[model samples]
Target chain A: MEYVIHLAILICIYLILAQAFNLNFGIGYQFNLAHVASYSIGAYTTALLSTELEQGFIVCIIASTLLSALFAVLLGGIATRLKADYFAIGTLAFSFVVSALLINWKSLTRGVLGITGIPRPIIFGRELNENLDFLILIFAFVLLVQVFLYFIFRSPYARSLKAQAEFEHAAMSLAKNAGLVRNLSFLIASGLAGLAGSFFAYYINYIDPSSFSLTEMIFVLTIIVVGKPGSFWGVIAGTVFLVLLPEPLRFIDIPPSILGHMRQLLYALILFSVVWFNKANLFPVQRGV
Target chain B: MSLDILPQLLINSLIAGSIYALASSGLALTYGLLKILNFAHGHLMMVGVYMFFMFNDWFGYEVIGSAIGCIAVIAFIAYLSLKIFVLPFTRYSYVLSFVTTLALSTIFEAWISMQFGVNVKSLTTGFQVHSIEFMGIFITPIQIIIILSSIALLGCLAFFIHYTPYGRRLRAFSQNEYAAQGIGVSKTNTSYVVFIVGALLAAYAGVMVGYETNMQPTMGNAYTIKAFAAMVLGGLGNVWGTVAGSYLLGLVENLSIGLDFWGYSIPAGYKDAFAFMIILFVLLLRPQGLFNSKSRAA
Candidate 1:
């Protein structure tokens, strides 16, 4: 039961990330790879606040979300001016900067030693000590985000995003504020990623630079791609399936040493084959003049 | 603070720039031709370095022999990767092609770690480290080899891209793929040649970098970002500009470490961050690239 709950919480965290990422890459066609960086910011913020300042759950979550959103605004400001491929490269550079700070700002982040013994969230004058309690809290937040995203995807704003993605000039000629829509979606997506990061810090009770590296980013990217980008129901299903897919590896009689890499290898192969088979069908080809 | 550190820093910068040039030139070519960024480009470099180590260090092959064997092996891998991982998506969106390379990168890193263990391994060059001192400057023999080889290779590339019929065909294709195809420039043949050449350059860079630093699975990640920054700074898809941008990056990165500004100097650990800052600043200030006059083709 505890193991099951752990998996559930992991799913909840990834769902928020994938759903948010879907809004950017899937709908807006903005390949903002700094998402994991924003998530790292949220996690690190919560970790520092709770460990150093003795902040409560609400304060940390709110701070992390807002800070990540602010980061998104800045990132979007710099990267949105570029085209798709350059935008991806630019955001990737920003992600590297964030990772550098995390690892090199030894005085604040304690460097690679990592911040440990992070206190779990204190809720309403009570400490949520139970694993089940944390799972419930996380699940509630996930549900809220999913519903919120569902509405956003259905709105005219989403249509504008898709329009801009398909044809920026056409969307602009149609009087859609393409820039504004891109920034708004970017802000919301990164903010939600931050929220997920906060939950990750609380649940794991330890936060490290290793957890937020590019490898983790690839995992989330795999979820959206496999689920079929730009589809709400698809990402949700992708999240559940991918999160649970590797669970069966535990029962195999492989050495623990190789098992971890085996999982990564498995995911890589899956991602490759899926993209290979569905390359033609995955995303609509960007319309050119 | 003194003139003393200038010579060493300049030499260091040159060495670093050469590696960056080698890495990014291939990236620029592939992007120029296919408009796809192979995220696994650096990982292929890593594989080349390992192959060199296996032949030179473990099997006791001569230095030149090992490099040749490594290049041949990497060429085969490059051909396989182009066919299996990169080519299928050429007709589709470049974004999907990018994702495929990303997946390929993950596969390479994981497979390497499982095989070699995660420990950093050093390349034994079969000789003691020898640095030649001239006019208050010290240079290593291996460093000299790296710089010379990079120049030779890049010179050959420039000659190929400018002086040969094949080169004209390549340039024509990058300019207008449909027009090139209309003139009977086979897409498959062009992609295979460009892809293999790019891989060869990256493999040579991998061997040089392995000589310069300890080998590890994740080493490719930093190089990929650096190469991207170089490619962008030089102007996306501009091969000559990439070389200049790389040399500039190497100088700036070295200067950040070697010189103190206002009693403060950037730490060596933030060298990669400096590259990122350069990308951000360049993208914001001059989207056309720092040196390039023409804006990139949208």
Candidate 2:
């Protein structure tokens, strides 16, 4: 039961991540690799605030989400001014910079040692320490985020954003500020990533630089692309498929070292095959006006 | 630092820069012709180095011969992979090709790790002397070879691109593939040839690097980033600019290392930070890069 709850919690975390990524890639058509960096910033912020300042869980989560959103604003300002590919490159550089800071800012981040012993959430005079309770909290948060995202996806704002993605000049002619829409989408997406990061830190009870590498970013990207971005259900389905698909490999009689490698292999193969087969419809090319 | 130390550092930087130039030029070529970022380019080099090592160990082939043979084998495999898997999807979205190549990179890395454990292996055939003196300054022979080979390769590549019929066709195709096809250029054949040539150049760099340093599967990550940096710095599709960018990057890195303010020595890990900082600054200041003046911003 504990294992099942743990898996459930992880699914909720990944759902948040995938949906946030979908917002940028699917709605804004921006391929930002720095999403993981924003996620890391949130994790570290919560870790530091709770461990150092003795802040409560709720305050730390809010602070983490805000900090991530602030960083996203800075990145979005630069990214929205450039071409799509340049945005990707710029975000990749931002990720490296964040990773470097996380590794080198030993006085603050404790370098590679990471932070530990983060306490679980406490709500209304009740401590949600048990796996079942924690699972409920996570699922509620995920459902809330999903509903919020669904509303945003259905709104006229989302329509305009999608319009900007399809043709920025056309959208502009229609009295839409495409750059502003992109910036808003990116900020929201990164804020959600931060929220997910806080939950991840609280659940894992440990946060490290290794947990937020380019490899992790690529995995999230794989999920977004595999699930066929732009649809809320598509992202949810993608999260479920990716998280659950690698579970059965645990029972295989392979060396532990090779087991980890096999998972990566399978992910790579699936990502490759999906992209190849769904090249046209999946991630339709957005023309710039 | 003394003058002698500065010269030595310069030589080392040149050698490192040369490797970046060689690998990045190939990447630029493919990007120019295909408009697809070949994420597997670094892995092509990784596989090539492993093949070179295997040929030397198993067949007892001479060092230079095995290097050439490794390049041929890698180029052939890459060509076949492109023909069989990539060519059929030429008309497809660029992102599909990008994802496919990235997956191929992961697959190659995994297969190599599966075949040979993640232990770093050193090549024994290259020059490994500590240092050699030249004009009151000390440098390694390998450094000299690196600089000379880079210059020679750049000159040859320029001539090939400018003077040959195939090269003119490639240039035309790079400009507009559809138009080139209308003019009777076979896009399939052109793409295959360009990819193979690019792979060969990457293989050559891999073998040379193996000779200079220890070979490992994870080295591809660093090389991949450096190549991308060089490509961006020089501007995509410009070979001369890439070569120039590599040397510029190398020099800046060496100068940073030589910088000692108030007797505090910056660790070598800061090299990546410095390179990336420069890349970010360049992106902000001049997105078109140093060589390409036309802004590609949409």
Candidate 3:
């Protein structure tokens, strides 16, 4: 029961992540590879505030979410100015910068030893220490974020984003500031990703640099691509499908060491096949940049 | 701080830059022609280095011969990757190609780890023991060989691209694919040659890295990023320009190792970050890259 609840909580966290990714890459048509960096900023922020500052849950999550948003603003302000392909490269550099900071800033991040004993959230003056309690909290976050995402998708802003994605000139002709919309969307999605990261740090009771690497970005990208981005329900299904795909392999009698790599191998192969088969609909020549 | 280390650092920079230059030219050129990022280029080098290791240990092949064989294997993989995964995606599927290459990179890393059990292996051959000293500074024969090899390879490539008929056709195709095709260049045959040469060059860079530093699965990623920095620093598609960029990158990267600031010394581990910072700075200040006046933004 605990294992199943653990899996559910993880899925909840990932649903928020995949949805946030969807809002940016899917709706905004911006390929920000630094999503993981913002996510890590949230994690590190929450971890540091809670452990170093001895802050409460509300204070930690809010502060981290805001900090992550601020970083998104700084990163997006510059990154979104570039053309599409260069935007990816710029964000990738940002991701590496964040990663370098996390790994090298021994003074702040503790340099890969990671923060430990991160307390579970205390809600309504009661500590939600148990796995079940955390699941409820995670589920709440997932629901709240999902609702927010739904509104964003339905809002007038989303129409502009849609127009911008389909054709920037068309969006411009309609008096939509495509750059402003993109930056704003990038900000919101990064903040949400931060929220997801906070929940992840809280639930796992641990935070490490390894959890937020380029591999994590690849995993999210796979979910968005496989789920057929631009559809909320499709992304949700993708998150669930991919999160659970490796579980059955765990039950098989494989050695513990090789099993970990085997799962990644499977993911790589699946990602390759997905792109190979879905090439035309995915990245058409007309959408070159 | 002693001033003696500066000269050594300069030499180290030279070595590091050439390493990056050798590694990145193929990736930059492939991206130039096909618009595919070739994320697996570094991993292909890692695999090639391992092949060199296997050939040396198990097959008892000579060092130069094994290096040659490494090129052949990677060329095949490059061609296969293009044909099997990359070419199927119609023209201008940049995102698809990028993601596919990224996926292939992951596969290669994981596959290498699974096969080799994540153990680091030294790849220096019997012939790598000799060194030459100048002005009380010692340099290995292998380092000189690596440096000279990069220069020769880049020179040969530039010559081929400019002087050879097929190479000119390939460049013409790169500049304007439809125009080149209209002019009767065999686009298909040229693409094969491009893939083969690009793969071979990247593989050669990998073997050189493995020769100096021991082989490890994770090493490919760091070098790949460095190569990327070098590539972008020099210019995206210009061969000689990238070579110059590589040297500059090597100097900065090596100089950062023992860097002192305000009485606080920076750790060597932070060296790679300097390159990434350069990349971010370049991407923002001039996305066309330092040496590139023409925008390769697309």
* Candidate 2 off by > 4 Å: A124-128, A286-289, B1-4, B58-60, B84-90, B126-128, B135-138, B176-178, B261-265, B295-298
Instruction: Return the interface RMSD of the candidates, in order shown, one decimal each.
Output: 1.1, 2.0, 1.7
Candidate 3 positional error at B231, Å:
2.3
Question: Per-residue alpha-carbon lDDT of model 2 for B246-293, expressed as tens digits?
Answer: 888888877787766577767665677766776777787887788887
Which one wins by TM-score: 2 or 3? 3
Model 2 chain B worst lDDT window (10 residues): B88-97
For model 1, residues A242-262, the per-residue Cα lDDT tens digits are 999999999989888788788
Question: Could you give the candidate ranking by lDDT, starting with the highest?
Answer: 1, 3, 2
Best by lDDT: 1
TM-score for each predicted model, relative to the true structure: 0.97, 0.93, 0.96
Task: Give lDDT tens digits, candidate 2, residues A156-264.
Answer: 9999999988778899999998889999999999999999999999888899898998667767878988888798888798888899898888887888878766877
Candidate 1 docking category?
A: high
Better of 1 and 2 by DockQ: 1
Kindly report which residue stretches of model 1 are placed more than 4 angstroms away from their true locations once superposed. B296-298
lDDT of 3 by residue, A118-183 (tens): 888899999998899889888988899999899888999998987787778878988999889999
The DockQ value obtained for model 1 is 0.80
